[model samples]
Target: MNTPSNRPAKGKNRAKLDPVYDLETRERALALVSHGRSLNSVSKQTGISRAAIRQWQVRIEPISRTSKCSRPDDLATYSYLLGLYLGDGCLSRHPRGGYVLRIACADAWPGLITACRDAILRVRPANSVYLVPKQGCVMVTGHSRHWPCLFPQHGPGKKHERHIALEPWQQQIVDAHPWELIRGLIHSDGCRITNWTTRMVNGERKRYEYPRYFFTNASDDIVRLYTDTLDSLGVEWRTARQSRRAQNVSVARRASVALMDAHVGPKY
Candidate 1:
């Protein structure tokens, strides 16, 4: 009888062979390639072919090199970056690998944006900085895996909504470069301005003006850190009237204003 043999027909096996990969696998594989891994290496790790990895990279915008983890040695600059991150910075996972650090600075203060860019570059020399404009603010972004290591407070919610605390090592850095840290915090969410009010004295109406520094944030933890840092510097700060959106820490006392001016000047 013409029964089937143990082996299939010559072309039958080839016809039955289907694609071994799915969309998610292809994306992940391509992402690995984008993170500076060679096609051969990714193929070995994922069982994907080198040709397919190359095709995926060509199809999409290529991911840059994998970010190296390098702790910043510049104490001043590192502390400043930390404070900035605590105020208005965020870290997001890169599709391919590593992470992206973004800090929002107002358009009115272009120099702050430059400072953020410079600070990031100081730590991660291999990555490029990007300034993306949104309405009234500019987002300064750079890619690196070291950012989270530097700022462990990075997490899933707004700074005020989360439990933000400084590690002992981070606290030591801030203690050494308190001014830089304050500068970053003020640049992000605080401002120095002239506050004016009308008062009646001796049956006469008078207008009085005072220079004060105001730090507004939703996170009580961050505000506490701010006050604590100020205390360390022997500069007094008090909790001002609270609003629905944010809480205020005011440095309106004459001596305090002068002290802050010495450390954190206006965002010019």
Candidate 2:
């Protein structure tokens, strides 16, 4: 039998190119190509690819250029390690290669954390690129840069979020991982945080600050932190709309309460 090699193979373009792009750029490139920009024009202008530009505009969806990583014999570790490291920043501390996962769609639906977990199971990481769940998406990015500079950059002509966000859950994750999302989205919800409280401090409106943290389906910490922090600051906030599902049944009781006796009001 021929001897097997133990070394990891190199990428197609093995040089350490900057790994700072997010899904928004890809969508912007797609839109540009769809609007009649040529691949060469896109390349000269955006620095991605003639091929990628072509793929975006093609009538048939073309193949993805990003490489996927897998272990021939060690399939378990990277996959097993991804979740643990995601929480503790184990992989982010590496000397090289990490990635950001930014998910986008044309539909009017909000993504569930289950969708994120599913995507992670499907995509493979590249040489230096690895997949870790970034709140609602799995990040496949390089580790050299902190997350703040990684994905979902804010700027004019960038890909925009078409759907209303998932609320304080997304806010918490963005706080912890600024690179995971554009700061614009974080600030969008800033209004809610402040609006929930009218409690003035020193004659000025008190501001609610979001603590930095990552969001995950596996944990409630993000939600807990958000609600707790807001409550501690005396901000009058409620859980997300989805969270309101449980409260819906009792919501009708507001009218019913008026029909009950005050001394023996229906117990909550």
The best candidate in terms of lDDT: 1
lDDT of 1 by residue, 232-259 (tens): 8889888887987788988988988999
- Candidate 2 Cα RMSD (Å): 18.5
Determine the backbone clash count of candidate 1: 1
- C-alpha lDDT of all candidate models, in order: 0.83, 0.34
Model 1: weakest 10-residue lDDT segment is 61-70
lDDT of 2 by residue, 8-82 (tens): 446644445534556446656665665666778877888886765565556224223342222222223222222
Regions of candidate 1 where Cα sits further than 4 Å from its true position: 1-68, 198-207
Score candidate 2 by lDDT: 0.34
